[model samples]
Each structure stands twice: as C-alpha cells, then as structure tokens.
Target: MMEPTAAVPADGSTARRIAPSRGPETARIARGTGKQWRLFNAALSHTPDFAYVFDLDGRFLYVNRALLELWRKPFAEAVGRDFFELGYPPELAARLQRQIAEVVATRGQVRDQTPFTDPDGTTRHYEYIFVPVLAEDGTVEAVAGSTRDITDRLRGEEELRTAAAALSRSNLELERFAAVASHDLQEPLRMVAGFLTLLEERCAGQLGADARSYIGRAMTGTTRMQALIANLLAYARLGEVGEAVAVDLGETFAAAIDNLTSRIAETRGTVTADALPTVRGDATRLLQLLQNLIGNALKFRAAMRPPVVHVSAERDGTGWVLAVRDNGIGIAPAHQERIFGAFQRAFTSGTYDGSGLGLAICKKIAESNGGWIRVASQEGTGTVFTVHLPALE
Candidate 1:
C-alpha cells in the first residue's frame, strides 16, 4: 500500500483537487439579473401615470403607457414626434408650450396643473412636473416629466363647491329672513315700550317709585335686546354691504373723534395718530372701528385721570398693522380672549352701555379684508388693540 501511494508522486506539480462547481448557479443568476432589468424597464413604460423623457434640445424621447392612452395614438405614430409641435387641444398645447418654454428658459423645475381634452372630448386635469435630468458628466442631459390625472379630484371639488354654494345661498336667505324678522320684532317692542312710557308719564305721581323703577328696568332691557339684534344684523352684512377701499387711519381717527365729540369733551380724551398707512377696507367700517375703540378708551380711563388714545399704523410683511393704544383701566388677562368674541362685555351695563359687539365687529372687518386683530393688556395699566389689514397696493 505504501509503495502504491508513493509510486508516482501523483505528478505533484500538475495534479489538483476538484473544487465545487458554480456553473449552473452562475448561469441562473445571470438569467435572473437580465429578467429583472427587462421587467423594470417594461413596468416603467407601462406605468399608469404619464411619464416622459425628452432630449436636451426639447424633443420627446419616450412616453409611458398612460400618455399613449391619453394621446389615443399608437406608440409608433407618437414616438420621435416633436411633442411640442404635435398639436394637442389648442388650449392645452398653448399652456404646455408656455410652461415648457419657461422651464427651458430658467433651467429650473416647474410644476403646475393644466387642463387637456381627451379623445372623448371630456376635459381632464393634470398636475405635472418638468424636472431636469443629469448626465454622468454632471451636465443636464435632458428633462423627465411625470403627470398625474386629477380629473376626478377636480370634479369632486367642483361638485362639493356647488353644494356649498347652494347651502350658502340657503343660509344667506335665512340670514336675510332673520334680519327682516328682527326689524319686525323691533316694531312690536317699540309699540309696547311707547305705551308703557306713555302710561308711566300719565300716571307718574299716582304710581309708586318702585313701579317707576320697574318700568325703567323694562325699558332698559328692551333697549339692550334691540341693540343686540341690530349688532347681529350689522355682523351679518359685514362684507356684503361694505365696499372695499383704501382707508386712511388718520382721517378715520378724525371722523371717529367727531362722532364721539361729546364723550371726548366730557372725558377730556385726546386721540393722536401718525400718518397711518392707507389700507384696504370699508371706510365706514373703519370709522366705526375707530369710534368703538376710541370710545372704549375714553370710557374706561383709570379713575381721576384724563384719557389718552394713541392710534398708529406700520407696514408689515403682507399688510398694514394698526394699533389703538389707550391709557385706560386695562383688561384682565382672563377676559382678553373673550372680549373679541361676539356680544361679550366685561363691565356691566351701568358702567358701559353697549351690545358687547364692537370688538367682534372690528374683528369681522379685519378678517373680511384678509387680516385680523389682537390685544395685549394688564388690569389698570393700559389697553391696546392692533388691527391688521391688507395694505393698499
């Protein structure tokens, strides 16, 4: 056995052991890799969204499955056709051409929605992207774009809009009815108050002081209710009745002072304003806005002090922000948020006579003009009301 093992040294320089073979598996792997690439490319072409490739010079190189369906033309006819030169619907073609020109001019990505007419003559909406493609050398090689058909979404939106419009119309009719009804209710209440007042006058001394007080209370309640109704109607007609215009805060302050001239004289109140920026709003509302705030400032001054009202305006990023500050008995922190709400009043009717709606109306006016109002105050220090409105352009 030993002699057999050593007989020929097994040709040590040339002989080698057999290693495991990988031929079949390697061949299978190569086939699988090819299959994956082919499948990937196929899926890309057949994708549902409209995807396209264009050359650097703005020529169509490829279109995906959905685009073919949209164009309703065979790939053979569409392939290599000048995408921009090929006439789509006139409107669609014009828009697409404009957007393409813009993208090419800027060399930046562009996105927008456009409407296209399908072969069936139905309009379809698409949100599309036009993005630059880069080459291996880091240069822009071409543009690749994808478009999503948002026709159904647009249709649903339109339907919902129509429904909302109808509902709004109905609600407006109701609001009008309520306004009419408020006037109607006021007529009857006025008649009752007139009779009560006449009776009180006629029977003054014969009636006890308690009876007179009761009648006075009744009159006050009726007046407050009437005021509340009027305020509600005013709020309802805020934008509908008020015209949009440039309001000069300085001029508005003068008018507001005139309206409350008696109160200003009584309280010795002073209102000073800068050359406030002209803003977009209803002039009458602006006047009323100043009147309410200036009046409040005068009415709520710290005890035994002359009132001072300061109104100024400055340009913010998107608009003019106006501030009406006052040295008055400032509002409490807990009441800051509530004061702007409709029909909210901190002081009693004895201290202040109002429907508790002035600030709320001010807010409404600000919002209707695409802006808003805010407040900052501490009890007994001062109060400031800031109103923001779209500035006059």
Candidate 2:
C-alpha cells in the first residue's frame, strides 16, 4: 500500500488530498469518492442561499458558489480564510466568530440577522443560522452555516410601519379637531336657544300663530344641534379612553338597563336578557354600547305594538357573540351598512329622535376592543345587532 500524499495545485499550493495508489482497486475507490464530492459541490454551488462550513478554529473550510460571489473572492482565497481575513467588519466578524464558537461549544444552532454592504455599495439585510456538525462520537466536528438575503422583507416591513404611523397621526389630528370644534359650538348654541325661548315668552300675546311657530321651530333646531354637538364630543373622545380590562358583560348590561329604566317604562318596552359572558373590554364603553343598542330598540318602536328587546350571548369559538334583538321598525337593507358611519341615520330626524352617533360609537367601541358589531334586519320586521367579543382569558 502507498501512503496518501498531498496534491499540489496549479499555483504550487499544497492541498489536503490522497495520493494515487498503485492498485487499480484503490484508484477506482479514489475516482468514486471524487465523483461524489463533485456531485455534492455541484448541488450546493447552484443554490441562491450562501452555504459554508467552518472549522473548529473559525476558519472557512468550504464556501459555496453563492458565498464566493457575495465575497467577490475566488474559492482558493476564501476557503482557507476566516471572516476577519476576508474583510468583514471587525465587530461583525467578532460577533460571527462568537456565534460560531457558541454552536461548537453547545453543539447547537445559533441564528442572527445583520446588515452588510456589498462591494457595489448596496447595503442589504441577511439572516443566517450556524449549526454544529457532529461526529460519530457525538463530538462537535465543524460548524455549517446558511445565510439568506432578507433585505426585501425588511424593507416591506419598514414601509408598513411608516404607513401605520402616518395613519395614526392623521386620526389623532382629526379627533382633536372634532373635539375642539364641538366644544366651542356648544356655548353659542345654548345662548341662541335661551334667547329664543325668552323672545317667545315676551312676544306671546302680540305675536301671531305663525310667529310663535317660527320661534318654536328655531328652539327645536337649536336643541337638536346641541344634542348633535354633545354626541360629536363623545365620539371624538372614544380615542382618548383608557385601556381595556376584564369587564363583566352582565354588569354593564344591567347598568345600561337601569340608566334607561324611565324611558323603557315610558315607551311600554320590555327588555330581557340571558346569561352574559366576561369579556376583555372597557366597562364604560361596553355599557355605552349596550345603552345605544337597547335605547335604539326602544326609541324605534312600531306604533302598532310595544317594543320587545332581547339580549343574549352564545359561544363563538374562544369568544362570545352578544346579540341584541328587537321587535321594532327594522332598518332597510340599503341603510344598514350606511348607518354605522358618523352622523349617518336610516330614518329622518323628524321621525327618529336621535343624533345618529349611537351605532357609530358602538362600532368604534367594538373595534377598539378587538371585536366587531354587525346588524341583520328586514325593512318592516325587526333588527338583530350582534357583537363579537373575545372572552377574558
């Protein structure tokens, strides 16, 4: 048998290799091993991801074609060099060396992300993982690594963050404007209503029926305007409310019913409920939501019969679906979706006494609590408002 010898490259550089033996059997085995090595190299060389193997000393033992291209160095130059010798930044090289050492010491994987500038001056992000290669004895032999370019993914995420920040600022500005405008208008509206009432009282005997009617209409207009302004302020302040907490829907429902007790009696309306669930939400907002829905049911009753509103909850996966069903003048299909928008009303103010912010506020509360509210109705029958809220964990 002949001893294995080092193969010399074209540059006269000594390389680790096995010298050809005299026997044909040894030569056949060497050829088969070389063919397998070629096949393995070819497969790795074609992949877009950078693949490499590092010796225990943090020196590169092998680098795939993608890595060679990234480094802009030939195989001979990169294969024997470490990160520092290959011109990686000192800090980055040190970090990589430490991670490689960790993988070797723990016999586990280490993953990280980093930014690198190419020779062409284009900086890109990369995510890489280093894993230990184990020998038959369960000892760390070497560290193998793969790096993927994540620049596009990171760029997309940054863009989305920028858009979200812009939207948040815009919403804040709009809410502030609404609050200021509604607050400033209220005092003047009150003054106008007060003066109109005084003028009607003073001129009662002298004025004709038409004059009194005009004054009465003017007072009514101002009253409705005041209500609208108040509702606007409330809606604007929704964004300024405190964070959500665990709230018992049953308690909020009871409170809402208690608040509307007088109106319920006046309208001859009956409000009933089933067992309610505990939800993750603000108690005040949840109470307001119930008040709005139940109040609407009472207010929009058909003249032919007294109102009947039923509140119930059922399990929906890990959450609960709260339903407020009412036998009243149901909304038209065309107007159901529109009514959720700010100041949108399905019926005229003359027929329905409301500022039209009730459903809109309910919708906002639902969304802020990571839930949603929807309505189902036929024109003449009744309406069902369903709110889906997550259960408190």
Number of the predicted model whose TM-score against the real structure is largest: 2
For model 1, the stretches where C-alpha displacement exceeds 4 angstroms are 1-49, 53-60, 65-124, 127-147, 156-160, 239-241, 348-350
TM-score of 2: 0.86
Q: Please, what is the whole-model Cα lDDT of each candidate in the order they appear?
A: 0.76, 0.86
Model 1 C-alpha lDDT per residue in residues 75-184, reported as the tens digit of each score: 55665556556667566666666666666667789899977777788887889999877668766766778999898998999999999899778868878977898899
- Candidate 1 lDDT trough over 10 residues, lowest sum: 1-10
Best by lDDT: 2
Q: Which ten residues in a row have the lowest lDDT in candidate 2?
A: 6-15
lDDT tens per residue, model 2, 1-393:
334332212132323464757789877776666565566677777899998888898888777878778778777787767889999999999999999999999998999999999888889999999999999999998899999999999999999999989988887997889878987898899889888888988878999999998998998889889998889888987885556789998898889999999999999999999989898888888899999999999999899999999999999987899999999989998898799999899998488777889899999989888899999998668999999998898
RMSD of 2: 4.2
